[model samples]
Target: MKKYVQEATDINVWTSLKEDTFDRGKDIREFIEGLELIEGNAFISLDAKWGDGKTFFVRQIEETLKYFRAKQMETEEKLLKDLESYEYLKESVAVKETTVEHIYLPVYYNAWMYDDHNDPLMSLLLVMTKQCGGAYNTKINTKSLGERLLAVASSLPISIKKINPATIIKDLQEGKMDILSAVKTEEDIKECVRDVFNDIIVEEAEKLVVFIDELDRCKPSFAIEMLERIKHYFDDERIIFVVSLNKEQLIHTISNYYGSEFDATRYLNRFFDVSINLPEISWYQKQKVQCTNSERFWITLIADELSDYYGFSLRDKLIYKSSIESLPRDVGDAFSQDKMYLNIFEVIIVLLDMVDAKEKKAFLEGKSNILIDLMPRIEIYKKYILRSFGIDIRDDCEEKLTEKYKLVQEVYEYVFGRDTEEYFKEADISRNLKEICIKACNGLKS
Candidate 1:
């Protein structure tokens, strides 16, 4: 089955946000831009549950800042040349112009990817240097910074052998250094690190916005150490750190590192200056209506309804859509009456198998109430299913709605209940419908 993959590239991020699928991108971008008003070093946290698209949201903000930064440079020709591979941005840049005055240099670092390194500080510095090099087209001098890092690493309570010399100090790989005398004290090392950051800001952009993502996915020690490193070493007036993570998971990681009785939430609060929860997807929010004939439209609708009931993440919704797409084309025919309920069942079965296989197994094993209990109470899904049975719910009258729901329940019983086979035979319930659904569900599980 096709999996959901988010490409970490500027053009892909632009394309995804240009469509503004969630409709909250513009507002969130404006909020991020407002961070420029905050003086001194600011630490902001973008909190979301795992797989809820925190990474995508932050990347969208990153791209927006980069676009405006490019605009500030007045190098439209060079920008266009850089984006030559993505022709969509040629017109996009013109249409989506912002009047924001303050734009900071943005750097995205995936903390989980580099957590295996000896020091979070070293990993962070390397990323900042590399990204700055690409943005400014000039190599940054990290010799002094590298020596000081070695001194700091040596002084740190952690093992010095864990430090990867090749990655951090490429120029000093063959050179020898007395780590003891490189820096006098902790204050001296902090000052040197601050100077390095200042040099980067001076050479590249006036201000820096560093986005640290996936910290929660890192090891407990690594995650805690990263936060501590950021709080101590990278403090600067021209720098703003935006860290994206599932705060709950990070709290658990903290509790794991400390004791289970430790107050992880209170401890985590010390690291962030400001925290914002990533917006949850709301069904009531006005979304662009899809064409009724579109297969994707139906699949998305079904998955969305299930998501509301099951708390499926953005990733879960994508996976559910993919599972539905993997079925036989004949089984997916929307226009065929014989396949209408089958298509809906296929969508439901795929999701049920994903989230609650035990419940699905019980339903397949002659327990009709298992499926009935799991059915979503949303009006749109109910209306669509009822429409198949030639029942149109035109009014919101309580008695009529109740009667309609009972009809839906009876339809479920007729399709899934083994005992109702003889009773619903006159209603033209397909004899092979249950058998086909069971076979499909088993095939998916296997």
Candidate 2:
């Protein structure tokens, strides 16, 4: 019944990195460690396809940076003693090792969650004020921050509640005051906002790293506005913005906002100083080295093999795994027992139905060239056959492997072919195998 992958919590991030579960932890830590060389304000874009673990990756980076910040503070004995009271910090091996050299106050913001706000800049400022203030235990001057925001609000052409521009014009016309003197220019407003940001960073850490996630998921106008606001107002030496998104989706969003003819790539280039693609997961390599006879291991191996065959994204693989896991206990046991090939085909049919019903229909209608084409190409079935029959591929002849494949293909045709009942009656395959395959397929559908 699990519908979605869990969001990365602090403990999840720490544990995953500690275990190197996805095998990218050392690279992630090294990437954060390299951030120490950045000298000024930077806008870094971490690009990945949707559901390619961008959120998790960025969260790990944020946690790693926080660990570095704590380590930096621990250089002072009093601060070290204070940090000892935080049990979470004690759990991080990175903190104990001091893997990163620089300290950056990190703030994570979900842009999609805040897209409903009136202003992206205001929402971002509030997040910075809260996250940085709470993390470092630094007392922010809320009154001063509020006053600065109000100052910017008042000078703008937009209306604020109860502020009458007509009254100001009347006063100016009556020679009561100079309207120009009261008005703040664009540069003045930018400086005011910059000073507010500086106030938050100066007392907390040497630099502020704001990790903006889900930007591509927001409304196009809001996403563009966020980029513009960062470029204009946050041009300071002590701030870094790490925006994570799918660049292709963001480009589509831009095209939706601006006309399709607009140069979104060039426009996007103006916002980011550097861009990095999330590293791909090495599923095949990992699977080859995995040594386990557990049901989950085989299930994961099947999912990984099929995922590569179909070119599934990380998210797709997760959903496929979940689908397999949702099957009955007996169905899973069938995979680990005799006739695993039949059980695997049932799983494949279910996956085809889930991912491409038209293809599944085509496959069931006896136009199984698609599935047949895959039989010789996939190594999982070959490995399974070899393991199940106690035959080593290294010592076996090519003709024998071909005969085994022919036998599998014959079973496939008899079970899933058009007029399957006729073929089922004629084939020598066990009635129990047919019953199990049918029951599994029906169970998964239900």
Candidate of highest lDDT: 2
Model 1 spans > 4 angstroms off: 1-5, 82-97, 139-185, 280-304, 331-341, 361-368, 375-446
**Prediction 2 TM-score vs. true:** 0.74
Instruction: Note the Cα lDDT for every prediction shown.
Output: 0.67, 0.69
lDDT of 1 by residue, 1-446 (tens): 55545565766677766666566555555665568578888899999998777887788777767766766775778777764333443334322644456757889999988877766776787788778766664436555455446656555555656666544576332223333234568787687677667656754476789999999999998899889988987778788899999998899889888999999999999999999888886654422221122654554566566665676676666666566655554433223544655656666678768888886666555454643454446655665656655555665545555564565456555677666336463344466666666565444321
User: What TM-score, computed on C-alpha atoms, does each candidate reach?
Assistant: 0.74, 0.74
Model 1 is weakest, by summed lDDT over 10 consecutive residues, at 284-293
- Candidate 2, 1-446: lDDT as tens digits: 45545667767766655655565665575567657778999999999998778988888778778766776666656555665333554454444444655568889999998887667876787778767767776656555555555565555454545545455434333445332233468776677667677668755387889999999999988999999988988888888899999999999999889998999999998899988888877876334323232665554566567776777666666666666666544643343332455546766776797688888887666466555567578887677667655677789455666676666666676656646345354334553454576666665431
Candidate 1, after superposition: displacement of residue 443 in Å?
8.6
Flag regions of model 2 displaced more than 4 Å: 1-5, 23-25, 74-102, 141-144, 155-185, 255-260, 281-285, 288-301, 311-319, 329-341, 353-369, 382-423, 428-446
Model 2 lDDT vs. the true structure?
0.69
